[model samples]
Every structure is written in C-alpha cells, then in structure tokens.
Target: MKTTLKIAGALLAGWAGLAGAQPPAGDADIRHGRYLIQTSGCNDCHTAGYMQKNGQVPEAEWLTGDAMGWQGPWGTTYAANLRLLFQQVDEQAWLARARQPMRPPMPSPSLRAMSDADLKAIYRYVRSLGVKGSPAPAYVPPGGKVATPYFDFTPKNLPPMASQR
Candidate 1:
C-alpha cells in the first residue's frame, strides 16, 4: 500500500509538471493543509533555505519547496512544492497523494494517518502558499547559524533502511 502511494505521488507530480497548472481548491481545507505543514515540519525537507536552529517555517521560501539538506540513499529527495503541486488536484486526490509515504527520514505515515477532514484542511492551507520568488538559501550549519527555530534534525548523511514495525 505504501509503495503504491509513493508511485501514485510520483505519477501525480509528473502529471502536474506536464500540465503546468496550479489548480488549488479555494476552500477552508487550504487552511488545514497549512497547519499540518507548520506543525508537521514539512518545509524542513521540502523548502530550500538555511534551516534555522529550531523548526520554524522558512520565511523566505514559505512552501515553494527546495532541494537542500536532503541527503540520503534516495539521492537527495526533495520536498515537493506543495503550492505548485496541489494546484489542480481535488481535496481527496490531494490528501491521498500528500499522505503518500515519503522516503526514509520523512514521516509520511503520520500524514497517512490523518483523518480526511484534517487532511483536507492541511491540503487547503498548503495550496494557499502561492508561488513566490524567494530563491533557495545557501547552506548554514543545521544547528544555529541564526536564531534557533525549534526542531533541527540534520542526520549524518547515510543510507536509510526500511524501519521495522
């Protein structure tokens, strides 16, 4: 089931890329998605900026997604730009895809466990992070080059194995 979701997510992303449209649903669920992203620390992996000491949202990039500090056996998995990625999909589709298991180091299972309503809220919130111009930030030590954010977990670069239940 997890593998299927991963493949679905990849396929959805590919389809979105080909369509070149941002079709976010203009609803309250967007707010939920935003909350999920915030509390869940989605940007830590997706957005590209020098992660602050704590796990606060990267103000510069917001939810544009980025490719930094994402080193693993997956070969630098990037957090998908939720704003652009969820533009066109419906709430159910978005939730299903968003809940897809992310590669190791990402806790997609928790997201998968979210209730439909909760997931919809999160999806809506994420969709609202309209594409912006904050280019990626340079590398700063994951600890504290700036004011500490909240939760910093930059693991030593290594291959990830499937975690046993």
Candidate 2:
C-alpha cells in the first residue's frame, strides 16, 4: 500500500512539472506571434518608417500600415494595417486569405509556410492590439497611377537588338 502511494505521488509530481513547463495558452500564443512578427521584419513596410527609425516604433504603433507603395511590373501595392485587418475578419477567413496569392513584395509564400498555430497566434496578437488606422490604399494595376508616391518601376535602357532586323 505504501509503495502504491509513493508511485502515485511520483506520477502527480511529474504531471505538475510538465504543466509548469508550458505557458498559458492565450498569453503564450500572442507572445510567440509577436516574436515572429518582430524577427520576420513585418514592420519594415507595415509600419511607416520602421527601417528608417531602426524599429524604434512602440508596440502600439506597430503594424498600423504605411502609404509607401511598391511599384513593379505587376502593380503598386500597399502594406496593410494588421490591426484593422484582424478586426474585419475571423481567424478562418484570415487563414484562407493568407493561403492565397498576394501582390508583389508582400511575401505570400512565406506566409503560406507558417503553421496553422503560428497563424492563429498572429491573429490573436493583432487582435489584441485593437483596431486602429484606415485601410491601405487600393492596388493600382500595371500602367495605372496611384495617388501616393510609389517606388518607381523603370526598365533598364538597352541597345537595339539584331534579332529585330
């Protein structure tokens, strides 16, 4: 009987230790997402002047979106304000969208590589920030113009080719 009690106590102690090793669900998810966002350079374009400021923007101001647009053969695309985005959609919708193809410079491939849990954590973290800022400017198709200043897409000058003759 004493041996059985000792064995039970050992199992209980082991269980408690395992529980203590893991962080509480909500907090852990949000924190992990925040870490990923910071390390993955999400703020570089999502937050205005992030690179210029060397990432000094406060957490509250991060992911608020920017007016700077990326221009290329595809079109001009703007960085989205993540806080507003999460508020506008549920987790499943966001995940579905994240899986879809995105415009130039948005790194959709990288997003697709993330696990569902990481995506959920990102959703939770952005939601926790609360909604702020207006939606980013609409995308401009190739050969179209945008209201905001954008990265100019210019083709390199080349000499005439003999093949044309």
Candidate 3:
C-alpha cells in the first residue's frame, strides 16, 4: 500500500541521517580541555588581562601569555605562550615534557598528575586556539633582572624566636 511505502521511506531517511552523524572525537576532546583549563586556573597566568578583566577575555585572546613575571630564588620567569608552544611540538613531546619536573610557580606536580587523555585533550584544545604570540621570556638567573617588575624573592627579616630555658 502507499502508506507502507511512505513509512518505509521516512524510516530509511532517518536511519541514513543517523548513520552519518558521528561526532568527531577531536571536538569532544577540545570541549573537555576547555572545561579543564577553566576549572584548573590555566587562565590565571597564561592569559593576559585575565585577572584585570575578572576572566572575561575572549577565547581567541586566551593563553597568549602574560607580561607578568614570577620572581624567586630561581629568578624571573614568564608564562609561556601556550598556543605557540603546541605549534612547536607534537602531542607526544608535550606529554613527555609535562611528565618532567617544572620550575617554580608552575605547579608541575598538578600537571604531572593529569591523566594522559586529559593532557592530550588540553594539547588539542590549545592547538585549536591557533598560533598566537611569540615565545615568553627565557628564564633569568638569580643575579639577573627583567624589564618587568617581578615578585621579588628576597628573604624577609624576622624577629628572633623566644627560647625556653
């Protein structure tokens, strides 16, 4: 009957659409990475004006690196431009580096604790942000200085502790 043919045609069309509707894993990974980055405070150091704007910067401008430098016994260190970093290295290399111990203020232990899948997602997401900005300033030694004012790491004088006889 005509009704049976119509139903069959509609069902076949629906099935065809479903068959071709697989979501890309890369997109899913990027979405997950975005969530992870936001929750894990990646923007705090990596994104310029993030703190000034209260984290309202556009996605395109995110992870472009900041002018603020962290100063310590190790000297001044700048936040690296993550977008450009991915362009320089492959995912495996990134994972390898992430596994290694990082310098001060970088929270290397937290990064190292991330699952490989999560790190891959982050790598994919940063790459998706597209290449932007040059590399951050190189590490400065203890006696060296940087153009930007950094958090000085000089030891503070303290009052002497009272001793019990």
Candidate 4:
C-alpha cells in the first residue's frame, strides 16, 4: 500500500510538472522573425542611417531608421524606423509595400517574391528590434528639372566607390 501511494504521488507530481512545461508560442514567433529580418537586409531602407556621434557610427543605433535618404524624388523621405514602424505597420501594410512597384535604388524584387509567412516573420523581427526616431532627410527629387547636382537622377557610370565595390 505504501508503494502504491508513493507511485501515485510521483505520477501526480509528474503531471503537474508537465502542465508547467508547456512551451510558449509567442517566443518562437519572435525569435524566428528576428532571424529573417537580419538575413533580409531590411535595414538597407528602413533605417535612415546609423546615428553619428562624434563622427563615429554607433552599433546600437543601427536599424534605428536614420539611414533613409530624404533627397530623392520623394521629398523628406525618411526610412521609417522599422522597429517602431513594424508595430504600427501590420502584416497587411508590409504586404502592400512589398507588392508595390519598385522605386529606383530601392530593391524590392526579392522581397516581393517572399512567401507571406516570410514577410510576417520579417515584420515580427523588425518590431522586436525596438524603435528610435531618425532625422527626416530634406526632400530632393532626382533629376526632376531640379538643378541641384545632389538631386541629379541620372545613373552615374562611375563604379561605386572602393568600399561599395
């Protein structure tokens, strides 16, 4: 009888532990999303640029949405800080942006082809990164009869500087 009671108690304890052992679903999604965002290079557009402090780029400030160029045909274009934007921009918003026609210098070809699941994962990852407000770039449309050389829309034949090469 004592053995029986011991076995029964053990079983009860095991069941209680199992109940507590259930894995969390939210963590899995957030982790997966973070992996996809890093691989996708989402920061190339969404981050206005890295923040410069004392003329040096800080690693922590990366993906904070300061990388966006405001001088393109689109005026005051600031790459929405993906971290914050992801929270505000849902899966649908991301899907629409992905499907829209590609604008010059912004590469959407690969993103447009991504599966819906992938897009969601990417969005989730961006949101997890966290947001910091980036400076708004002044609007300068490319080559729109605008005389500013900085705004010239013409594709330069010169190879990108040594770093880009």
What is the full ranking by TM-score, best candidate first?
2, 3, 4, 1
Q: Which stretches of candidate 2 lie over 4 Å from their true place?
A: 1-25, 153-165
| Candidate-wise lDDT, in order | 0.61, 0.87, 0.86, 0.58
The estimated TM-scores of all candidates read 0.54, 0.78, 0.78, 0.55
Model 3 weakest lDDT span, ten residues long: 19-28
Q: Residue-wise lDDT of candidate 4 within 1-165, one digit each (tens)?
A: 999999999987887789435333366777777676556665555543322233244435545654334354443334555666566776778879877875545556887888877776666666666666654343444443433222223445768889987
Kindly list the per-residue Cα lDDT of model 3 for residues 1-165, writing each as its tens digit: 999999999987887789545334477899999999998899988998897799999988999887788888777888899998888998889999999998777889999999999998998899898999877778887778588856666657856667732
Counting only residues 3 or more apart in sequence or on different chains, how many pairs clash (N, Cα, C under 3 Å) in candidate 1? Answer: 21
Question: CA lDDT of 13 in candidate 4?
Answer: 86
Q: RMSD of model 4, in Å? A: 9.8
Give the least accurate 10-residue stretch of model 2, judged by summed lDDT. 16-25
Q: In angstroms, how far off is 108's CA in candidate 3? A: 0.4
Predicted model with the maximum lDDT: 2
Instruction: Enumerate residue pairs that collide in model 3.
Output: none
Please count the clashing residue pairs in each candidate, in the order shown. Answer: 21, 0, 0, 11
